[model samples]
Target: MITRTFSHLVLALIVFIWIVPFVALVSTSLRSETEAKTSGFWTAFTPTVLGHRFSTHDKGSTVEFIEMSGNIFDRLNGEKSGFLVSGEVQSILIKARIMNPDKPGKTKLIRKLVPAGEPFETRGGSLVFQSNGDFTWTFPEATAPKPKKLDVFINQDPIFGADAYIEVLFDNKNVPNALISSFIVTIPATIIPITIAAFAAYAFAWMQFPGRDWLFVLVVSLMVVPTQLAFLPILQGFSGIASWATALNAWLTDCEINDSCQVASKSFPSLWITHTAFGLPLAIYLLRNYIVGLPKELLQSARIDGASHLQIFTRIIIPLSVPALASFSIFQFLWVWNDLIVALYIGPNNASDLVFPIRLQKQLGTFKDQLHLLNASAVISMIVPVIVFLSMQRYFIRGLLAGSVKGG
Candidate 1:
């Protein structure tokens, strides 16, 4: 029991360690850029710190007082010899420099505290008064003071923790459009490979033909190839395809009466193709193994019923292979959703065609000072994957565990 409790504590600690950064990330994202820079996210949650920092009335140690200087008051013989004191300060600290007629080179400071509700009298060359921050400087004598003017600067000390509302701003309008573009690129990229691989996997598992096993081996072996080698060649090929497509688009635009052609030289379709090509090997490998393990009796029963291959696949295999399909779909979706390299190669880097991943990265270079925006964009980018995984997690686990154990 003790061991079990210790193990749980360890697990909880690990989970907490993993969770803190994300909590910080979320907190950072929720604040305005100015707020995020001054303090960390954890500070927002602590009531003690908040109360100490932003409370206007609290004279706590954590609070920083701001010093404000008022207008220089010139005390003359005929002048009222008074100036208005600002703010709700209980006490005023004054520094007054007076020119001495006796010693022309010497200046004297007549500094004193004038507590609230008492009038400040000018002593030689100084004045002090205090109020609920409305004090007036007065020279008791009618003659001009030794110094030409007495300048007073006031300081207001403030406490922290007043603002409870933190607005997480994702004001970059480009992000939502880029997210839509990512979805456009990802959903099709995920679905197309799965659809194509499912057929190939079904054939590899169920159909017998010349070189069939060899082909399955070849397909599986391709998964071993590092994607870096193919990236440049694939990009080159996509550029050529895009060039041709652009030519066709230009022709269509020229032929049209209303010539508002917003055709891109490259776009989401190319990204989908690149992602699908890169993702297919894994899809086929996982799906083939799962399909191969499905009972042969079911395929035989379907065959005996005169069901066509396509019909059997659509009606029988797909329904039963939901777990495997879902697993691969999640994998491909996340891969394409988060990929910046393939999207960069195949799609235009401009805002018109950039995906969310690329959009978030653009903030680093083009708008690095917008730290809050980057955090918010990152959080926004993560939402779909989180939702996808959460919704399909059961199927993902079931798929992994499907052939792990057998009763027979």
Candidate 2:
């Protein structure tokens, strides 16, 4: 009982460790740009003090007395999602240049706080401030002091909204297209490999063939080979196929006449094939391990009833291997969904064809200061993988356990 309690505590701790970053990511994504930058996600629910720097309007050499009256909050960068929910002035500091007490005939610049709800007299103006961020300034006649900079601090209630998500999904053209492109690339890339691997794995587990064990061993050995090593040859092969297809199309139709032929190397089929080829070794290995563990009596009974190998595979093996297939599907779907390196190397180069990872990466450079949008994009990217895993979680555990030991 004590050991079980301790194990539960350890599991809870591990879950908490995993959940913290996701909570922070979600909190940051839901906040305004000001809130995201000024405070950590932990401080998101409480009131926060944020500082802003702005200047009074310049009169520009006019010798007339003028009054400047405006809400100091208006000087903030225009974010209209009620970001300054119930804002009040916490403090204000005004810049001033004064004669240096230590150096003769020299001046230095300094800032001093303007007391709340009080008129503070300046060299050119007298200013009155309010806690709600309203301010009035009356300048003396013929005094043209340069625009004085004011550093204002405000205490504001927290506000949360979907502005970041809206911008990421709708405002950015590439993001929406990249989302479609990701679905287009991921679905086929996942299904094709699993379909092919199932057949190969069943053959290795049940079928009688010459050199079957040797072939299965060779396939398993391929799991250790780095994908990078095959890049050159695969690319060359794809390029050759593309060139031949292009020439054939050009000769047979108006493609060359209209100058409309496209190189097939950078299309969706090429990417699907590349991912399928790379994923096959592991897929077959895992499926074979699981399939080998199936009840041998079921297969023998099917054969005794005069069922062919194909019929037994379709009628018996495929039905019983659901757990394993679903498990591998989750793995392949997540991998292809999050893949940037493979897609960038062999996938389409056009803007409309770029995947989510490449598009999200470009946002880092293009919208460097818009981190809220980036966080929103990151969260959006995780949604599909989370759904895939959750849907198949029951099978995942079963598949791992069943595949661990083979049946006689």
Candidate 3:
């Protein structure tokens, strides 16, 4: 009993810790601006609708009540008099009534008895009345409008649907731009580092060289350096390169004969170079460790067979290192995809050059009144990361042992 209880407690605690952040994010995303400012989502169930009472002033006269439901502007749709009545019909009393001319025998009266003490005021249209008795009614201003009902897979609350997700995803323009910029940085960042590192790793493991240990040590030391400290200098350098490119463009445009050629050649190769530089040290270290652990007999036999270093690397080492490479690629891709700071510093922020993450971040600021779109954007930003993780999971599992055993 004690063991079972302990296990249950552990499981419950784990579940709670995992679920809490997700719950909070969802709740906050669902809350309206007014609700968010006034109270939390926990208080959503409290009734927000208001009520008012309407009574006839004339004694001994019966008043018929009718209810109408539609958009506020639709109140005037079928009425003979387009004018809406509001404010006090007399001192200390307001009147609200809807006109119904269809009834032949009796005068039709409509009064909505809302929650008392409601402070909303009607606008643009009024409730018309053809009552025998003088009547008074009071109402509060309309609350925020609810979304149209949608029925899909058990009627998900509008707050939890695509709209809400988009709002969260695109809440900031920087977010989407960041996502795209991450991809731009990651794909080449992963490929360039791995390619160079593979060659270096092969040489370090197989080729005898003076100061190899010292060189490896230098590479590893870079990993310990704080990335935050390096950011400003890197950013300044990138800005200098961009400035140079702009100057070059101005020079090219000054030459009328080849202005179009210069415009066509304006790609920022520096972006890729920066990512590769930042990623290279780690890549070389990881691939070197994996390559050095390969079976020496296989390499020796290849040498005896007169295979060149290039041939051995291409035919043997490269094929064997797929799992390690795949794992590293996934990591690099995700790292770049989620990066906003690096993209902001390295790339242009104008519409033509804006990345997906940046676009999502901009959307977030404008989403105060557009909850649905915000939710959709949130979901869009999450898609690539989720897909990448799922696709690369197998390689990650397999790559753990790539460098662990020599020939096991």
Candidate 4:
């Protein structure tokens, strides 16, 4: 009983830790700017309305109280200069003003307006003018008013619905493009590396040749080299290719082959080559180990039956190594798909060529005011990674032991 109780407690604690951040993110996403600024999301359950007293010295203490649903600025919709009068006051006038920061006594009137018996509409909140010129704003009111019900829309309040997902998928361009680019980069990157590496791994494992062990060791050593060390060299190589392509185009105008030769060009092709190069070392190492572990009897029997190396590799080795191949493909696909560093470095910096991460970063400005959009963008970026992880997870476990033993 004690052990069971302890297990339950641990499970509950783990669940709480896991859920807290997600709850907070959801709450923050749904919270209005005012709520986020003033109180925690937990406090939102017990709501409060802002109350303002509208009165003037000339009005002789006939004060009007206004209950508002939201922040003060929201109630004064673009009108800064205004006298707080009784709701019964006809021809109510209000003026919008900005307090001068440099000059204390001076007020700059930005706008003037007459109360139209309607309050300004904002997300999750509404402004209502009392019979006196005093206006009160309310948000998600405890009891909605009767007769003419006021609908308050508070912007930036946390919503507990699937709207977050919808907004991320449809509204966010970066996420979608990132997802698409991931697929584009991943599919070709995975397929090309696996195809080439499978052939190389087969030769290294089955074919006897001088310096084979040394070559394999060198390839494996390349794996330990930090990827960052190659960045500048790769960049320079691509830049050189771009330069060569430009010069070749100029020369093509003078060549007889110009009519038949289409310029075999694009940064994308180069990026594909780069991904293949980076992926090849690991792919070969993994597949070589798996292939070398396969039964030598199968290859010998196929050879006695007059099977060429090509025939044996194609017919026996490939059929048996499906798991290893699948596993490697999954690994390469996911790595290439989620790679922002490579894409950013190789991709064109312009909007037309910008990948998902760059586009998401573009949404976030240098100032704090752009935080709402930044939050929205962050949610957008996570969608593709989630999808990729879910789709490829099965291969991880299923293929690890594949081709290691003779029988399944």
Candidate 5:
């Protein structure tokens, strides 16, 4: 009983660890930038106090005015601005900094909470800031001060929406294109390898051939080899092929030699072939292990009924092996979908062909401060793989555990 309880506790802890980051990621994606940055994701559903700096209108040296009147919320840039929001602020704090006359370029900052519906005094002025966001500033001097900006902090309910997703997905051309390009790259990369491996696995399991066991061992042994070791040789091979193709195309067409006529070494076909080659070793290994565990009577009965190998494979093997195929499909799909190094090395360099990982990586460098958009992009990239896994989850365990035990 104690051991079982301990095991359940461990599993619960593991689940919680996995869930926290996803919860935070989703929460941060939905929140306003200010709310996301200012407070932890735990505070996303609560009222938040957001600080904003707004530049006041300076009427210039010629215009003399002791007082300035406007609504503080008027400075907010509405929905277009990532952080700024306009509403009736129930509580507020005002902060201002003025240059010290004694020290050039040095300033002192003042922060004070305003009484409800009452005027607040500052070092530079007396301010009446209301919950409705209206404010009046009367300066001690004859004219408004230099620099002409004030910081206002207001408390309000958090803003939550799909606005971040909209900006990340539709507003940015790279993200949307990268998404489509990822699907294009991943789908073929997955199917071609599975198709080829299924035929190979069936042969290794059922057919008679010279050095069959030795060849199966050789393929299975390849699963231990790091793909990085083959990169240099494979890349050189691709470059050579592309160069030859480019020369042939140039000779065939009467156009000047340029990228337009040059074959891209990192095209979609190259990516599919690379993924297929790398995936085949494991795909074959898994499917062969599972197929070998099937009832021999099934195959013999088909053979006795005058069924050929191809007929038995298509009619009997394929249908019965759905669980194993689905299992390998999930593995291959996720691997290809999430791959970055392979994409970065042999993948397309053109803007139109960049995958989600590369585009997301570029966004990391370009929009380091835009966490909201980054989080949204991360979530978007995970959506397809998650859907694929969930849809095929029932078959995952059954297929993966194939050959581990035999039925009586």
Candidate 6:
């Protein structure tokens, strides 16, 4: 009992530590930039109050409260600008003006800093509010012939401070296009490498050929080389090829050489090829290890029954090796999806061929003022990988464990 309890405690601690950062990341993505800027990412759990920040933008004690949540908590035209309702403000949205820091200006628009559970009341309006967000606004019979009366209900979210995700979605307009481009770059890069690696891995594992071990060693050796070193040469080669293709096209067809012969200069093809080359070594190594351990009895029996190599490979090996394939597919998918450096070097800064990571890098470098977007963008990038992992996590773990056992 003691041992089991201790083990459970340790596991819970490990899980908590592992999960904290992801929770923080999610909170940051859903946070308003103003709130994130003032407090920090983690404070999205308990967002800070801006404290009825709206002041006179148009002038007069009657400040126009921008309509929010079908409840416009405007200031009454009176001696002092006081809140309209009393009771703990569960949460609210109203436009308020603050001193502009950018240049000479009286006030700039900002959200009201009224966080949920903060107490508030209109002293002049003779109003009282409760913690449940119910408020009663009243006026003396002298102020109005028939006494003015009002009640307001505010919705409360105990977990989140504000509906910042909605605001963030509307604010960042390029997210949809970036997401599409990321898929385009990631899917092909993943499929091409895995398909090619499976063929090569099977050959190395099962077939006997001259210099086979040496060749496998050489391929594995290439994995150690940094992707940076190869970029210059690949870029130059593709440029040369594009130029040749352009010249040939002009000669063969009616198109001018200088005209848009869009064959090169940071394109989809360049990214696909770059990712393929980078991912191939690891894919081959992983699949080869897994394939070698697969039961030799199955192979021998198939061979005795006169089944050809291609038939056996396709019909037998592939069907059984699904776990290893899935494992590597996840790895390559996440790597290509999350990669920034390869995209930076091979992909042009232009949006036409820009992958998601490259686009995010541009946002980070070019728009320093919109720094809060980094968290949102990072969360978007992880969506596909998270889904893939959650769905195939069992296969991924099984493949790794199977491949790590004693070699055939």
- Give the lDDT ranking, best first: 2, 5, 6, 1, 4, 3
For residues 139-221, write the lDDT of model 2, one tens digit per residue: 76645566666788878777788988898788788888999999999999999999999999999998889999999999989
Instruction: Mark the 10 consecutive residues where model 6 has the least summed lDDT.
Output: 63-72
lDDT tens digits, residue span 284-365, model 6: 9888999999899999999999998899889998999999999988899889888888888786566655777777777777
lDDT of 1 at 43: 62
lDDT of 2: 0.85
Clashing pairs in 6: 50-113, 51-113, 54-96, 86-129, 87-129, 87-130, 90-116
Q: Which one wins on TM-score? A: 2
Q: Candidates' lDDT values, in order?
A: 0.66, 0.85, 0.56, 0.61, 0.83, 0.68
- Expressed as tens digits, the lDDT of each residue in 296-393 for candidate 3 is 89999999999999999999999988877877777677766666665666656566565666665776676664543554555556667779889888
After superposing candidate 5 on the true structure, give the runs of residues whose Cα lies further than 4 Å from its correct spot: 53-111, 121-127, 130-150, 257-260, 403-408
The candidate scoring highest on lDDT is 2
Q: Candidate 6 at residue 52, lDDT? A: 36
Q: Comparing 1 and 6 by lDDT, which wins?
A: 6
Backbone N/Cα/C clashes per model:
12, 0, 58, 38, 0, 7
Rank list by TM-score: 2, 5, 6, 1, 3, 4
Query: Following a full C-alpha superposition, what root-mean-square deviation does model 3 have from the true structure?
Result: 12.0
Candidate 4: minimum summed lDDT over ten consecutive residues — where? 82-91
Per-residue CA lDDT of candidate 4, range 1-408, in tens? Answer: 999999999999999998876666556545444444555656544433322322221224333333333322244333533221111323233345668887898988654333436665433446555433355555564533322222222222222333334555687555566556656666787789999999999999999999999999999888887777888888888777777766776676754455532333335666688889899998888788888888888899998999999998899988987878877877786677657788777755545555566666665553244333445556555555567657766765655665334221
Q: What tens-digit string does per-residue lDDT give for candidate 1 at 274-377?
A: 78888998888888888878888988998999999999899988998899899888889898899887777677677766898788777788657656666777
Please give the TM-score that candidate 2 achieves against the real structure: 0.85
> Could you tell me the lDDT of residue 149 within candidate 5?
61
Q: Which stretches of candidate 3 lie over 4 Å from their true place?
A: 1-182, 239-268, 369-372, 401-408
